[model samples]
Target: MHAIEVCNLKKSYTQGENALDSISFHIPQGAIFGFLGPNGSGKTTTVRILNGILSPTQGSALVYGQKVTANSQEIHRLCGVMTETAASYENLTGWENLDFFGQMHGLSKTEIKNQSEQLLYSLDLYESKDKKVKAYSTGMKKRISLARALLHRPKILFLDEPTSGLDPESAQNVTQMVQKLAIEHGVTVFLCTHQLKYAEDICTLYGFIHKGNMLGFGTFQQLLQEKNSTIYLELRGDSIPPSFTPYQNANKIYKIPITGDTDASQILQGILKQGGQVYEAKQIHWGLEDLYFAYQRGVSHEISTKSNDL
Candidate 1:
């Protein structure tokens, strides 16, 4: 069963400005879907629509086949959302805040207590559990908010910039927990983040958005193949072979772009035959950063061409 589905979903504000323009995608069960985009690119807008915090101007979103608009309460019950700015009572202690949310979710008193304790420990907040939220640091508050989101054991988890202000250690801990929830607990994660490196580390699939539109959606490897950017071969040697065209790099390393795996192997063989000792023969694949620039460049080129035509 599909964990989340959005069909031609669109949203516009009062100024007749469309925030999202007919975006559509499906996330399979147990998959970590990374919703990537720049700030104000409608990533948060899409998350709000899916959570039923905001209604779409057209089309719809579904969680486990349930309509978000008509069955918002049911959708809420089945999903957990951790936004960048989550609300909690400043006067309440961290433990109290979590306990309150757990109770609101209809968890039993004993269950709420147990779950709160476990989550606090897991999030490394056990020591701070008794401290009031107003006294907590930004990282501490973020951790507490995440704990609240998971209190109900929701099947679908939506996290928007979950680690934005967290320290490196805390961020790594949260990332591991997210991966474990999706892989071991069979939870579906919809992660919206600007941190491309972090997204690459944990996401199973990616949806790249720009200017309120989805540029592409697929696995990382699939998107890389579609871009057909290049596979750079770095050869470390003092001498260059006659058969190989040396790239312009001042270092002893020579770089070449190969079309595919076959060409890569052929280049290696040719270098070996010419008595060039290869200290390093590594394939440099394009990362998410490369794909983002390529997509942005395409958009820019299209806009420029249209302007010229007009």
Candidate 2:
């Protein structure tokens, strides 16, 4: 079963203005799905709908085949959510906050102690566990919130800007742990982030949104068929093939724009057949950052060249 599924999900606060417009996508079990967009582009709103905190104006959201609205409490039990504004009780100690949330999740004293201590150790917050949340730094608060979310050992995680206040080291450790949970424990992670480079490293699937519309959704390999991506190979050889024109700046250097994997192969084969002696070849690959900007620069949802492939 799909970990999460949304069908033509739409939301509107005002009469005519839609916060989310006809967006549809699904995330597989144990996959790290990145949901990306600019501020006020409906990223948070979408999360609320999926968690059943807010109902959509139209369409539906399902978590593991359970309708969000009908099974809201059950879904809450299954998901560990760490939102950007997920706050802790300022008067409570770090340990107290975690203990309370753990009880709310119905974890026993033994489970809470084991889970909380482990998370505190892993997050580098064990030293400050006795300190009240009001005295903690922004980074410390973030870590504690994360620990609270993870106390239940939930099967699904919904994290929004999880690393916003974390230092580089802490961020790396957190990501590694999250990856481990997804890979080893079959935890489905729905990550809402603007950290494109970081997301590129960890996310297996991606969905980009702009102005309340889904620009595109798929794995990087699947989205290669879209127009925005062009893998270019610059070949310089002893004998430049006549079929391809030489690059403008360099003599005997030919630039090839490969649209697909097949094109790259065909170009190389034809060059060899024509007695072209390739001395050097440089290829430039388009990554998530590149494609994300490509979508941002677009005017509409028609970012994918292929009507159905991506």
Candidate 3:
């Protein structure tokens, strides 16, 4: 079963001004699903709706086949959410804050203490555990909030820019922890962020949004197919064969449109048969960052063309 599902999900705060369009997607169990968009693209809005903080204007959202609205409490019990804003109180010590939230999750005192200590150490905040949250640095607060979220051992984690205030090392640690939770612990992670490079590193699935509209959604391989990504081969070689005639470019480079790895090998063999002395060959495929920009540009161009046609 999908960990989370949305069907024609939409939201509008004002007449004729939709904050979220008819977006739909499903995150499979144990998958790290990345919700990617620029600010004001409705990433956070969708998160709030899924957490049952807001109702959709149309359609539905479900967590494990239970509707979010009618089952908010049960959903909360099964999920842990850490937003950009830390939910812990400034007056409470880090340990105290975690303990309080753990109890709220109905964890036993011993379980809460053990989980809190484990999280603090893993997040590099153990040394500061007794410090009041107000006295802690932004990174420390973020770590504490994360610890609180995980204390209950929820099956699903909703993280919004989880590494925002962290140093590079801490950020990497958090990212690694997220990977472990999904892959090792069978947790479902829904990550919302503008951190393209990090998202590219960890997310198993991705959905892109722009101006409240879902631009696309799929696994990396699936998206590569959907985008029909081009395969270009750069080579420092001599003499292109007649078979390679269509692929010649300035310099010694050639652009080969290959379907997959096998085609690349075949192309190399063809080049060799034609007596081309290949000094170096490099394959370039579009990554998440490249695909994102391409999608945006394509959308803009389509819109402009439509206006022109009109």
Candidate 4:
């Protein structure tokens, strides 16, 4: 079953300008769906709508086939959200804050205490459990916020830039925790972030958005295929074959962009026949960054061509 679904989901402010255009997508259960875009691209807006923090201007979002607007209370019970700027009481200790939220979620006092201690230990914040939130570092506060979000043991998690200001070690820890939650607990994670590399690491599928429109949506392999981008090869050889053109590279190595896997075998045979010895040959796959730029470039080119045609 789809964990989250958005169809023609549009949101606008009083200015009548849409933050989320008629966007649509489905996040399968147990999948980490990466909502990727630059600042002001409507990523946060869409997340807010899904969480029922903000109402959609038109259309709707559904959680487990339940309309977000119609069943917001139930949706809230089933989802955990951790935003970058999570609000917490500065006067309260880390453990205290967690206990407070636990109670709000209807956990008994004993349950709250036990869960709070466990979360603090897991997040490596046990030492700072007694420390007031105001005394904690940015990373500490972020971790505490995450712990609070998970206190209720929600089935789905909405994480918006969850590791925005965390140190490398802390970020790694958080990423691992997120992966564990999804894999071990079957928690569906909806991650919204501008960190393409990080997103690539944790996300099972991706939805690329720009200017309030979803440019593409699929797994990494699917996106690569949709772009029809070439798989480049780096070879340390002399006297290249006639079929292969010089691609991007430097010293002692040459690169070639192959349109298909079959082309690589033919190129290899041609090189061998020409008495050229290849030291290293491997397919170079395009990453999320490359695909994102390609999408932007394609959009720009389309606009330019249309303008010229007009």
Pairs in clash, predicted candidate 3: none
lDDT values for all models: 0.84, 0.84, 0.84, 0.82
Q: Give candidate 4 regions above 4 Å deviation.
A: 242-253, 259-262, 299-310
Error of 3 at 112 (Å): 1.5
| Model 3 TM-score, 2 decimals | 0.90
Error of 2 at 73 (Å): 1.4
lDDT of 2 by residue, 1-310 (tens): 8999999999999999999999999999999999989999998898888889999999999998999989789988888889886789999999999999999988899999999999999999999999999999888888888898889988889888888888999889989998999999999999999989888888999999987899889987776456356667667777767767745237876667766566766787788889878777666576677778777776313122221111
Count of steric clashes across candidates, in order: 0, 0, 0, 0
Q: Identify the leading candidate in terms of TM-score.
A: 1
lDDT per residue for candidate 3 within 226-303, as digits (tens), equals 877776665667887767766777677666666557777888888888787888776667778777766666631111
Write the residue-wise lDDT of candidate 4 on 1-310 in tens digits.
7999999998878586888889999998889999888888988888788878789988879999888888787888889889875677889999889888888888899888888888889899999999999999998989999998898888899898889899998999999999999999989999988898899889999998887889889998888788886666557766665455445367647667666567778877888898777777776667777777677566311110101100
Model 1: how far is 192 from its true place, Å? 1.0
What are the runs in model 2 whose C-alpha is more than 4 Å off? Answer: 235-246, 249-254, 259-280, 299-310
Instruction: Name the regions of candidate 3 deviating beyond 4 angstroms.
Output: 241-250, 299-310
Q: State candidate 2's TM-score.
A: 0.86
Q: Which ten residues in a row have the lowest lDDT in candidate 3?
A: 301-310
